[model samples]
Target: MRILVLSDLHANVTALDAVLEAAQGRWEQSVCLGDVVGYGPDPNEVTARLRKLGTQTIRGNHDKAVAGVMPTDDFNPVAKAAVDWTRAQLTPEHLSWLAALPPGPLATDGIVLVHGAFQDEDEYVFTPAQALDGLLDSTAEVTFFGHTHHQGGFSYQDSRLEVLQIHPRPTESFAALRIEAPRRYLLNPGSIGQPRDGDPRAAFAIADLDHQTVEFWRVSYDISSVQERMRQARLPEPLVQRLMLGR
Candidate 1:
């Protein structure tokens, strides 16, 4: 089965649309890690789109904050502002849907989907040590997680950990990796709406389970348009600027 893995789509429909367009005919099933809403405009539109696509999704930290499942007191000032704004933008039904999303470490077909670390839903597995810890704790052979918004992952084998960085060129669309069995892995497909890897493009991944390979994709979208919408909504200035900077 070819599964499209997406995460941290913080409500930028333009980026989501671009990713969907780029991934056309490439996947049969879709699974989202989380954060369907937060940090950007068009929360309702993005959630509706994901629903229509029938994506199996989990609740992200931002999603939890917006749905009132988690407190925003821990969020940064800019992030807290976005969450507050997004909470207001969502309708009753949308909020309910967001609230209903399950927490991760959700497993299927030998792969696990998580918004963050398997042990902690809100954990950010950015460093090699964190990745190793997550891999050691999880039973699944591969764990796909999001939260750091950086498009890469790590593999643990023979008591050694190796970082896997798939940095595509500006003109390239994706970077492919062959998944070797028996060796554990923790993968991050990156962020769809907000990419913090110094790349201002939408990020996603395709896991071809049948072929045992994972492909990371990055697609450009209308950043200015999303920024303009954020401006109109009076969202935080740093949030609007980050969309262009991809930081």
Candidate 2:
């Protein structure tokens, strides 16, 4: 079974569409780690498209805030501002869907999915120690996650843990990892809308379960459209500008 892993859509229809187009007929299913809204211009369109795709998506922090289930006060000034703006842009139905989404680490056959760390969906698992701690806590043999907006994964061999940190480069090749038996693994596919790893490209991952291999992927999208949308919506200019720098 091939599973196309995605996360942090962040309301960019362009990136989502590019990922989908790139994976057309290549995977049997697509799974999203969440953040379907916030920071981008097309919240409704993105949500509607994901719903139409029948993708299994979880509730991200931004999604929770928009649903009114999460407090925006804890967010930074710009993030708080963006969340406040996003909340107003969503329809009642969209709000309901966002509210209805399940928080993860949700496990399925050969894969575990989460919007953030298993300890807390809103927590950051950015460092090797943090990722190792999360891997120690989870029972899943292989876990896929997002939230730091960085493309990385951790592996445990015998009793040792190793971290894979991917840097963005054109024509980059993915590392193929093998899952033996039922050991623990935690993987991040990176961000789709707001990449924070100093790369201005869309990030994702692909898992071919049948072959027991997983690979990371990144692609460039029309960032200008998202910036324009932010302008039209009057979201924080810095939030919009940051997308270009992938900060």
The most accurate candidate by lDDT is: 1
Return the top candidate by TM-score: 1
Query: Where does candidate 1 clash, by residue pair?
Result: none
Q: Clashes in candidate 2: how many?
A: 0
Clash pairs, model 2 backbone:
none
Error of 1 at 127 (Å): 0.9
What are the runs in model 1 whose C-alpha is more than 4 Å off? none
- What TM-score should be assigned to candidate 2? 0.94
| CA displacement after TM-score superposition, residue 10 of candidate 2 (Å) | 0.7
How accurate locally is residue 232 in candidate 2, as Cα lDDT from 0 to 100?
A: 86
Residue 102 Cα positional deviation in candidate 2, in Å, after optimal superposition:
0.6
TM-score of 1: 0.98
For candidate 1, lDDT tens digit of each residue in 123-158?
989889778767888878889999999999999888
